[model samples]
Target chain A: MIARLRQTVWSGITARVRGTWDSVADAIRPAVPGFGTVRRGHVALVGVGPGAIDLLTLRALRCIEAADVILYDRLVEPEVVALAPRKARRIYVGKEVGAHAWPQPRIDAKIVEEAQKGLRVVRLKSGDPSIFGRVTEELTAVRAAGLAVEVVPGVTAACAAAAHMQLSLTERGVSDTLILTTGTCREGDPLPESALHARPGTNTVFYMSVRQAARIRDGLIARGVPDGARLRIAADVAKPGEQLLHCALRDLPDTLASSSISGCAILMLTWPKEVEALSDPTVATETVAPVSAANAPS
Target chain B: MIARLRQTVWSGITARVRGTWDSVADAIRPAVPGFGTVRRGHVALVGVGPGAIDLLTLRALRCIEAADVILYDRLVEPEVVALAPRKARRIYVGKEVGAHAWPQPRIDAKIVEEAQKGLRVVRLKSGDPSIFGRVTEELTAVRAAGLAVEVVPGVTAACAAAAHMQLSLTERGVSDTLILTTGTCREGDPLPESALHARPGTNTVFYMSVRQAARIRDGLIARGVPDGARLRIAADVAKPGEQLLHCALRDLPDTLASSSISGCAILMLTWPKEVEALSDPTVATETVAPVSAANAPS
Candidate 1:
């Protein structure tokens, strides 16, 4: 009887999905919601995962093992780059600000140069390669140069950070929206209007924004976001020197200062909807009293 | 001189990270940022990537191999569950609607029961378990049961969809924000106020929402989201029967109706900051010209 009703309700929905999906309407899901395209290719863009080599996806490992040359970013640990065969040339294309830094275009050209040589090229990035990783530019370059390139998705840092912190990026009703955005933009681009997007039912994780901590905090405060919008600062997540710290939004700048944290950090700003602890049976006992989520019964 | 200048500029930045970090100020990073906590545990919450078993992180694979009792969701492929040792118990905790469904509480209790028996319990969820996975409830249950639990992150479906489409979730200088939100809520919860959060510079991926396609499309149209806001839908992403389709926002309803896509899909709604194709040198030639992002020079 329920199946009949469900079928009637979902007349346009595919029966295959409806059979397995409770949402019956849940038409879509993100298999790995960052990036993927299985194309025939000589060059591959691979996300090596955040910090831990163990976190690397099987696809990433396979891509690395098959590479004849690897152009890796700075955050990619040497140990990860070492996964390439001994004969593979490991080029350090780390984009730090010093003399060793390769500008975005240079990195693009180098990848193209190697791919044009008919060598298997791996453009290794930390975390999922498609988010805030300037992948479009490289992707554009590879295409413009007439090389077949494929992107192999890997564990993004945000997911890893949340896992390490024992936190969920999106809480059911409390935080229905999860936003991943960079805290900083291109050097000359206008500072991201980070505070402008705030709304109920939204959680934002800022990537590459620690130096702008003070400004970001001020913007959120100026925009009247409550201190209840707690800040979770995770540093070197999953790396040996990882640090997880929590504070109100107001303490963001100081937390980074005193925490001895380095780079590759994400600032998770969440304001889980307030719920009455006495009235809500689903409120977790271990959650911070003010910002706890209501795991309402389904 | 440049190194010294960079050093002076990065006075507060951790030397360890700055040596490897370009931002020098990246205070925290997501090393697979969905959900993770390394605790002493017999119960493990494992995210098994979106679909493909090989997409599973090394950590997730390890957790499954070590399990004495594996409780998996519906989206988890049988090949994945079969990875457990022959003696391991494979329990189906998938909460599909209908008589066979297991309530969330019962599933939690089952896990607790298994753990109390000194069994290695693996709570396997597809995609990253931290987002929209009802993990908090399960995590709470495990904690309340006084059992040590660990959450091993996995590649989410969003990453997989984007990769399959050869698209990036967040584009620099354009769509800097990526929002991951589900289409439907629990049976009783209010419909997600998705349109209210629409703003420039944001890309949203709607998970488990294909059933709500019409309503969602109506909501977006009502909220005045332009047709320029394109929709890319990928169904059964990375699975054997994966399908990738694209349409304008107004056409979302019909697109799904016409496409034979089943479940395990994600709706990727992207409004890449409009760029003048002629002026933006870095704009991808292959990108839909109207929705292309300005790959602005850094």
Candidate 2:
């Protein structure tokens, strides 16, 4: 009976000491610049940019290094995750096209539970988290739990792909507007109606549209996009084995059929010949193979 | 006469030695990773991102460090320019909205002239060099001069503003597409017709649009966009004095009039009420004050 009473007293003292330590740390955080001020159980949604470790912002790297728990997506580069402290717990919650290792609700619950214990949590995503990142659902759940949250933006895939090709999404008197859309939708969800048509003097970039190239081709053609319009397809941008393919709008399907590209591709429709002709002649001729030669039933 | 003859002969010897050194360096550059293989007098068009030093990619930093001369835009942060070597020549070619300090053609000629002198050049721009960056004109001139050129992408203002708000540009079943356009055009250049309308399930971000808020409001209203639609104006995004303003589409003109935002602002149109209601309640209530309360007749 005496030993049991002693053990209870020791446990009480330990809890008090930890509480004191946490309070002291909180007091010092405000004085340090770039130090995470995330409240006990707060979450930071950080964008790591498109695969290049150097693209990570200083604020993002600071937050990752300070996190106690990190949940990362599959598209995030391994080099980026290495920036986290060695003692921090790393969890992989990546969701593939047909496979979701940890469903959305479960991931949300895990973050909240960890935060409740007063641990700093970070959810790392590839590219800018605001673009097709399903950030709304996660933000809703975290805020509903009454936890503090902040977002750090990173470079998206479209920007990286454009950099690779030395191509601009907008040019004076050529293309004044840029549109970002996806050709594929969820199983029961239908594609947006506006995406079915292409507007003149506008550059359109379709994310995750490689699998539906034929459908995209037909939709654009039906909406009066000329068959001879120039298009660019970038696969595995900013990584080893990166490939860039240029073709006429009608030959996009054929180009993909001959190539082995299954993941992380972007399709961009650029300005017409009239505007392109005014630009560099070298760029005009880089990939200007005859349409008949590219599509001659090879 | 003897002194002049000695000077000419010394210059000839120096030129020959420099040529040999450049040939040797070029031969070894291809074998080194991250080392630029730019021939002497080549130009690299690099995007430095939206003013944050950490937002600079590894490739961009490397290029800057290796440059003999750097021509930077006004929007690029000073912290980023500090990354260049101390001996590198820094040139300010900033172009303000109403002030054309250095005309486009002059800037283009300067870069080519420097390259012709066999100096490695880096043309730095804020945000992605391709999007509304007038890259085609500069690129055409550089290529016509027979110089090597490459482009490096950076995070644009739209992505940075969305990140600052912790809001996603594309959400499932809400906004499936994102459009980026400008509100003001050059003299005699008409605004694109389709940009005036906000499509359902599409999020539109207008760059350099704060000064033209009244025109944007009238155009959208005429195109069937509801006056009650939610709008966000982000000023000086990702900068030290960054500010975000939330108001209805009808109040946008008044909001800008009341504030001191002239340039470096992004206007974003989110999803409609019906879709927003289906999402988080906190987001719904965060900026739902009555229009009259937000803008009293005082």
What is the clash tally of candidate 2? 1
lDDT of 2 by residue, A1-298 (tens): 3334323332232233234334544654575565435468879898887776656665576578678999997788776786676899999897775676788888888888888788899999888888877788788889999998888887788888887777788766666788888876555787654344245567788888888888887766544455666678888776555789888888989999999877688888864313312222222222211112111110
Give residue B88's lDDT in candidate 2 (0 to 100): 94
Error of 1 at A177 (Å): 0.7
> What does candidate 1's lDDT look like per residue over B144-182, in tens digits?
989988999988889888876778888877787888888
Report iRMS values in order.
21.8, 22.0
Q: What are the TM-scores, per candidate, against the unseen true structure?
A: 0.78, 0.78
- Scored by TM against the true chain B, the candidates give 0.76, 0.77
Q: RMSD of model 1, in Å?
A: 17.9
